[model samples]
Target chain A: MSVDVKTVKRVAHLARIAVSEDDAERMTGELNAILGFVEQLNEVDVSGVEPMTSVTPMEMKKRIDVVTDGNKAADIVANAPATDENFFLVPKVVE
Target chain B: MSDLTRLTISQARAKLHGKEITATEITEAYLSAIDRANPALNAYVAVTGDKARDMAKISDARLVKGEGGALEGIPLGIKDLFGTEGVHTQACSHVLDGFKPRYESTVTSNLWADGAVMLGKLNMDEFAMGSSNETSYYGPVINPWRRSRLDTVVMPTTHQGDGGFVSAGGTKTQRSLDNAQLVPGGSSGGSATAVSAFLCAGATATDTGGSIRQPAAFTGTVGIKPTYGRCSRWGIVAFASSLDQAGPIARDVRDAAILLKSMASVDPKDTTSVDRPVPDYEAAIGKPIKGMKVGIPKEYRVEGMPEEIEALWQKGIAWLKDAGAEIVDISLPHTKYALPAYYIVAPAEASSNLARYDGVRYGLRVPGKDIVEMYEKTRAAGFGREVKRRIMIGTYVLSAGYYDAYYLQAQKVRNLIKRDFENVFAAGVDVILTPATPSAAFGIADEDMAADPVKMYLNDIFTVTVNMAGLPGIAVPAGLDPKGLPLGLQLIGRPFEEETLFQTAAVIEQAAGTFQPEKWW
Candidate 1:
């Protein structure tokens, strides 16, 4: 199934990455190429086949859910473009 | 003194213990080599001179005290993907404008705990997405080894689908490849280039889908992607969570063994990190493969494969046979579907994993009217074209209407691919061998790759199957192509059986002998 320019734009929007008209048009062809490529999967007889969930089947190791470590709010926000008091600054969400 | 940069990890380890050379001396040698070669090769994106020497000094002290760790005194390069505690850890992407992680990745921490010295961060495909190094925000890394102008091979192209086969002596024969820049395959491109160029004793690299093995093969270096969860993914930048794995690209098989021994560990931090003890991989080297069942997967012999690659595969089979391996013809019938299935699964997970980069905490932030617009703008401006493309593909597949037809179907195909390998191994196949790449390193902006992205994805044709199964695979340099570029043979081992890969690869390394480029860089 090939993606139209509309589909490409929608996908890019859902992905939250901006794509200009030119890029979306280009991605239409590109994404279609990829979609066409992966279409080969239709040939496989997976009628009763289970989708793979994990590479290794192992019991999930759990630890005590208590706070093992913390108190480095500074380190967490150290690389943010804008921050105040270890709080990351972003465009105001609400008026 | 002789050029200390030429010493392999094993050789460097022995000399450090023998007191013939200090860690400081070896680090200096590699630093100087990197300084000279990096400008031309563009292998290392950052050179941590002070840190390397400081770490080397610590190693020297430990060696003197007879308390050195496994990788003591060995100077290594960290892939840009791995966080290196306050060092450059951007995954070679522009999105991470100035990211120096506060925390160290669990893999790099393990490396440091073993006394390995870090030379610097190497370049890679941004977010380890693309097959060629061309996708890096930092310009594509130039391979240290270039094709000789006088030497020529039948121009071979093995893309995918019906048109993959380019006729012999195809249109790619240009005037001179002697000076043309070839890519050390990505996303571990820089890791392979640095190790091959002798910029570091070895380099830490990762593989989601053949990142470690493809680059290593192109540059005539040795690289092994241990079983998924063999190395902790605690802090290595996540690409495709389920598929991403950490390993090493080193000068030779023994060095790869030495590095992996230190790199693998069980971590409480990464639930996926296997709890099994790391083997003395070095001890596995030189072990007899007399009774080992080396399976030659007949499905790997893809049509339109170059004569040299086919010949190299034959040579590998013969070498193992000579070393007393019982060669068995095997069938992994689902091999052709592996790469296409990977394109879906890897991207679907990548889109999810990359969602965390939306201008909130770290990395580039492009201001907009609102937070949502801000995220859209920042991600658009931040991520590279290939990254965006994969994100779009992933977003499309996981979208409401297409989820079942695309993503789920791909995952089911993944199960079939895994079953293919399982069936082979269950039948007493020790390790399956195949050609590492379709052709030797191609030009930087290869015509075929530029024309179609799927052509680029096909570069991992043989290697991707191993990752699909979560098994260990090693790429060892075998023979040189007609163009004088190195060709590599891949050995896919059973899960967590990296020792067997090391043992078998060492035999091929001995038979084919290791290759090094004529250093013009």
Candidate 2:
């Protein structure tokens, strides 16, 4: 679980952030520190312990399966940065 | 006229009903106050003066027609994280600098239906990432109470001191301090500051991991995070889907109740929203808390919590006891694991939620020679360092080979934490009492920022457990620290039992006495 500079670099790339070689070294150190602290959790005895999803014991409310969106495609797309006649426009992927 | 700023929401509503003052007058007063105070505090991302005035005019017409809602004509500040139709709803990030949703969030729509006037969009941490408002693209907000005359001498010693002194000492000090602004409690800091400064009556705020309550505590306001699904998240920008819940930030418990009632409803658009009937939250207001069972968790007494916070916690418990509530010692054995589990679960969800903002949607887009370049360059330039760091960490924790080790394990640990609370509640504990945070706000400096991020993450130790459990919690101003900054007492309630939480909070608020910061204006 040690986060090295290479792992840090890959993570940055995956996250779409540009990290310089110098900053990558620094980030690696910080990430390692965080992981080191998190490593403490390994010592606790959790055998037979149930993972909690919520503090309350109530079940999540189930909604009816239905599509009820108000047909506001034009309104929704009005906020998009770039749009075509009826769809969001982006750089050509197939070219 | 200035004294009107001191009136609570309930009192203001009474006056508006009695025809002693028009909604237009109240709206104008708050708009003027926001105009006068916002330049220094920077609490609002956008002020809706025209919208508020128009709403006020309508409210007056309703009054003339003998048709008014409970919160009619109350000016409200909507957090920028909540989508508003035709109003710029930037999430304190340059990426969405000019983006305005064509539809309003359900919470906003509810408030509008209740006749609440929109004051503006409040500022927040970019995408609600940071614990301090310094991460906001619009810059940090200053706590207004710190600007009061009585706080001037003691304030410089606290996190808010520098900004408070500089803003009041005129242009020279203001110019210098502007270069080195202090940190505002993040995510909901702007909402807290606006309420504390009397710039607005109350504001809408969201909490994924103590975002609303922590800031409200730091700024000495009252904030509540309702039970999950109690408030709709449809128009809210997603941070961590499971943990995110919207609530109200107000000057007192009554105001918080008023705002919460108007905003809570079952929304068809939000699949996660509860179908349960919305209650008359105000009906529970001022309800007696005598004979209630209050639990004091032993595990929340972390090692090296400031002595002041410990004293405040004890004082709050003592007050509840005096108010006819029985105090029982409870243990949340899984408390220590709560923080670690939350960091994992929250980030994993955030990584997935934020994937939609990859320069192809509504945010900033950098035109490049090709697709890959466009995605990389755009995101790299659009996001700030802290945001990038979080996104990277989140992505790593959820990636292949790491999922089982981190994300799944965290989920398992989260279950244990939830069970701990359940065990306590089953033993007749109605609510748990704890300190909202370990210490008061910290300074905004490289040294301060350079400290290990986990150390900063620990500040949410007492608050995060509630969110992890999907329970409702409120942060009420307990007392001031030695440095004269506010400290908050946290109240944790069982699932969807906010009525009990608010009643308990009111009893504590009454017993703890009122906080009166010295006025600068």
Model 2: per-residue Cα lDDT over B8-125, one tens digit each: 7888888888887888999989988888888888999899899899999999989767688988888889889999999979788887857888888999999999888899999888
Model 1 alpha-carbon miss at residue A94, Å: 1.8
Q: What DockQ does each candidate score versus the true complex, computed on alpha carbons?
A: 0.82, 0.53
The lDDT values for all models are 0.91, 0.82
Query: Best-fitting candidate, measured by TM-score?
Result: 1
- lDDT per residue as tens, model 2, A1-95: 78889999888778766678898998888777667666656656678876645544445666677875778778867767789875888788895
Error of 2 at B157 (Å): 32
**Native contacts kept, each candidate:** 0.88, 0.52
> Each candidate's TM vs. the true structure?
0.95, 0.92
C-alpha DockQ for predicted model 2: 0.53
Native-referenced DockQ of model 1:
0.82
The docking category that best describes candidate 1 is high
For model 2, the stretches where C-alpha displacement exceeds 4 angstroms are A49-67, B1-3, B147-182
Q: For candidate 1, lDDT tens digit of each residue in B43-107?
A: 88999999999999999999999898888999999999999898988999989988999999988
TM-score of candidate 2 relative to the true fold: 0.92
